[model samples]
Target chain A: MIDWALVARTLPEYWVGLRVSLLLLFVSCATAFLVSIPLAMARVSRHAWLSWPVWAFTYVVRGTPLLVQLFMVYFGLAQFEVVRESAAWPMLRSAWFCAWLTFAINSTAYTTEIFAGALKNTPNGELEAARSLGLSATQVYRRILWPGALRRALPQYGNEVVMMMHATAIASTVTLVELTRVARDVYYNYLAPVEAFGVVATFYFALTYAMVGAFKLVEKRYLRHLAPRETGPAAGRPT
Target chain B: MLKKLALAAVALAAFMVQADAQQTRLRVGVEGNYPPFSQISPSGQISGFDIDIANAVCAELKMECQLVQQEFDGMIPALAARRFDIIVASLTITPARLERVDFSAPYYDVPSQFVARNGAFQSHSPDALRGKRIIVLRNSPRAAWLQQNYPQNELHLANRETDVYLELVAGRGDIAFGSSVVSTEQFLKRPEGAGYGRVGEPVRLQGGTGGVGIAVRKGDTETLAKVNQALAAIRSNGVYRQIMARYFDYDISPSN
Candidate 1:
């Protein structure tokens, strides 16, 4: 048995943390999506120099642990004079900004791989047909190539977004007040791991489950065209 | 045939003895992020003030020590679930904690203090908060103090002491509250705390000085007593002072 009052009291703390965690998730996901498209294009290019830079960037970001990357960007970069003098320092000076940057860059590596695979699966015939239509290179990418590739990458991209939602848990390490951070505050009251963590576990379970639900909603919307129009099994549920 | 049977019996006994030796190992849990206290070295080996003391504690108990790395917030939960036997990660002994588990004799005593980059640190009462916000480590005694004293001000709670320092520097809020032991390294660098200042005269002037002790599962009285004896031996043998020097400059001796 546990005290419901204590658990109720802890909910607000977790909510505050949850909000920050979601904020981090949104910021990182948007950045990673923007970065991945260009990096994937470069990776698919014939030019060695341009593609190789993207390769090295992806390799280094992937090779290191997220904790080390957070430390390096937050504490390590603060050491350099050039970064200090640059306009980027305004963003870097913030722990939240630095954490968001780390999450974005880290996800970019994984997302780049996903985008590259999707790009590879882009039909050669469609590409040729797109070319015959006299579509400009950028137009071809915008209209045909990107949409098709993105459809192939949706399932994977969805997973990344969900994982990022949970990965926001680590932001607490660098000083972001996410769900895990609030768990610690609850611990102060109960001092009992079982009592405090019981609430925390529920918060995380709710959060992770909510993320799962949201991802599914996104998946359904993206794949709705594939869904049977007539006599589909129980089409929509009321909120 | 008789000789062969006798030799087999002796071999079985030797194997049993070897198995018995391995079960006597002591498992230690640590966060491994709080450097100079508990951290993972570049070589992947766990080493720090707590590690050294844990080793000494194990030696005194006549058991081999095994170090396990866990997040600070999850350490106690893991222990409750029997993931490990003891926590030596500068865990402050508190009443709220005692309800769920038990603690050994105090090993290190350090006062909980606050630092502010803003002009002189201010507080109307233990409960009062004007315009200034105090950042505190999540899941620590400072959070306990805030929750008990100023429940409304939690909206301004900073997750970690480091975050508090950064927030103070960024002018997000005003003060950062933590223990002397945790802030000693930063304050000593400033000498007069020239850049930063301490808040209030210091509360919990007696038992509230932030004494850290090892936490063990409830009902593990034997282990608790053994740990207390080991801690006392470390103090008497001067090993405590040596371990204290690695992470702290001040003499934060626990009153026996």
Candidate 2:
């Protein structure tokens, strides 16, 4: 059974946690989106000099667990005396900064791969048509290649967003006071896992639902051409 | 299908009966990361002051001691969930924990202290630490004390007790507040803690009974009594002192 009364009393704490989780989610998502574009571009580059390095970067980051990466950034860097004495120590010392950096990098790796796959899957005919229009390489990328790939990448990108949101829970281990951390603190105080984790699960479920629904709308608008032909009277009606 | 289910239930009952018959086995939960108190050595052996004490108590009870390594934060919940029978994890006796689990009579009462880079801080007063980062284990009584007493100071709550010192040594935090036993034995004695030293006097929070005790599930008075009896036997028979001598130069036995 759920403890509704405890849930009512802990609304303020959950609110604080929700704000932290949202901030972490939004900031890292934006960072990932921006950074991934360029990295994804390089990942799909024709030149091995550019694509191989990006490929290696994503390979190393994606191969390892995000939690381990987070710990390395948050705790591992501090183990070195040089890091402690450096100017960057001020930023590295912050839990928020470490968490954000880890999440952003992790998301960047996955998002880059998603976008790269989408870019690779771009129709050869589309590229030919863009070149035939006398568009330069940059113009082709901006006008045709990037837009089509991004539209194709929408559904998978939506999945990455949801996964990143869930991954933010690990930020609590570094003491970011996100939703999971708040739930853990509540559990520590009340010893009621049902009341603590159950409420957090609801919050996460609601957030995920909203994200999924929003992604659906975006996909519908951008991916309309890929959808099956409408079977309306004006469409395939016999003369 | 119904007949098979009934037969399976009968088999489970027999298994439970056999498990209950094993009275000699004692499953003890321990956080094998808290040095001096408990830690797993490089050889993967779990040994410490707490491990020795638990072993001595098990010896007295003539029970087979099985140490189950667990995280400090999850000790109580694990105990409640029957993951382990008792916690020998240097768990402080506090009212909040008392609400969930019953504790044995205080086995040791080590004072808390603040550790900072030597000569970096003069006093542990709020004014001196104002705006300075003070690291402590999250959800700890010491964190609660700092929140109440030193509101102006920034509190960085690390997940593990060792992290409190790690963050300090990493220059992330200006001061570390935690068990004196751990701060002294685990950190200051190690090479990594070369520049750090205790800066403040022994701090015992007013929130708890100010003693560390073994925790067992609440309402399990039978196990509680046995643990208490074993503790008394160890103390009277000099086992407790022998173990204490191995770890500390001073007496750590519960006062009063």
Candidate 3:
């Protein structure tokens, strides 16, 4: 039932689409990493004025569908006369910039919540120990709190990254020609949903596995001390 | 920040009011990206041949026309969901589509033609374009025709009619197939299209059933009859020809 010849002939096109998908994934994830840190801090802050706005942002963003958010950014914003007349129109008019901004902002909301939840759960004993040792609040956060929270948040954050990769498929609605778009085009031309979607399914499956594998490596390195003592034949062999 | 908040609040209230007031107006669905047919202008207003036709029909029927922007592929589903009363997009009548919804008499008919760079292809025959990269609009009759007749050719399906020409110009494909009016008026007459020209005779489907029509929900005889009457009224009056002249130099009526 597989059309290997069709797959071979169209692999190059799919590869180009894969590159675009990866570009969107990596760029948006990197930007989300940068933005979510401060947002997460504000989310857990003592000041209601500071925390409420960030809370509202995450609540609204996370509550709405990403596709609606994307359309609001890419198409709805352009519907305004003021937006078109503004200097940012040049940048906002580009599909790549719009997709990147939408993905990054959407991922930031979810990541911020993950990081905030981890931050709130930091052990009280750790904070007491740091204060008793005379570490200033800044130093304590920099050295102990941030590191511990980040390490705890890593697994959830990794899932967010994978989810963002899947979310990149929606960029095709604005004409980015990513992996799902390529598969759809091929399906349209060939009228073979089975073969076309099979290829896309395989690509996404492999990508998800690779992401999970990378996260596993990270967990091994960073959370090694948390692992139970190795008791297998090869346990005592490694450094 | 305060001004922006107030503006957003007002916009939200306006949307709520509009949603509540939908019963009295006629909601017409249109794919606003297809130039020369139905396009959203820079001012965010819908324009072009299909928009004008829809407006004229609404006027003839004495109903208020509120055009709703929709993607072509989702037009039928949206209609079934009652998001719109009728689809006035440049939707061609096809047997497969007739299974889902009913179509009024064709408002206009245009031939499908192939476009390529100068001297790229001699003809659109299966033998001539066997190994060529061909681009066609997704879910279009032209795409169906290509797949049925020239399955060996490398086919690239574009989401929009404009993208078909873009793929040809970008060297991703050797030829593109779409509405002759769009390829000629929207692309070939422009400066960027100087190197491209029509490569073959217009393609006619096996059943000779290619014509653009307005679609309504299946078994909605009252709306369908009203739409047909409006279409006939416009054709007899000079409104249809006047709208046609704004977009096309040659005749696009069914006879031509």
lDDT of each: 0.76, 0.89, 0.86
Instruction: Report the C-alpha lDDT of model 2 over A32-96, residue by residue, as the tens digit.
Output: 99999999999989999999999999999999999999999988999998988899888998999
Give the DockQ-based CAPRI class for model 3. incorrect
What DockQ does every candidate get? 0.23, 0.54, 0.05
Which of the two, 1 or 2, has more lDDT? Answer: 2
Query: TM-scores for chain B, in order?
Result: 0.77, 0.81, 0.80
Candidate 1 root-mean-square deviation in Å? 7.9
Give candidate 2's TM-score: 0.87
What residue pairs are clashing in model 1? A184-B139
Top model number, DockQ = 2
Candidate 2 lDDT over residue span B1-256, tens digit each: 9999999999999986777677688889988877678878889999999999888888888988989998876778789889889999888788878898999999999878999999989989888887898999888888888889898888888887788898887777889998888788879989989978988687767654468898999999988999999999988888898899998986778875
After superposition, the stretches of candidate 3 with alpha carbons farther than 4 Å from their true spots are A231-239, B1-108, B111-256
Please report the candidate that would top lDDT against the real structure: 2
lDDT comparing candidate 2 with the true structure: 0.89
User: What fraction of the native interface does candidate 2 get right in terms of contacts?
Assistant: 0.73
Worst 10 residues of 2 chain B by lDDT: B201-210
Q: Per-residue lDDT of B1-256 in model 1, one digit per residue for the tens?
A: 9999999999999987786556577778877887667778789888878788899999888888888889886777789887888998988787777777789888877676667653564643545455456677665666766666666664345656655565555544556677765565655255534567666654454535347889899989978998999988988998888888777766678766
Instruction: State the lDDT of candidate 1 residue by residue for A50-92, as single tens digits.
Output: 8898889889888998889987887678667687778988788
Clashes of each: 1, 0, 0
Q: lDDT score, residue B94, model 1?
A: 78
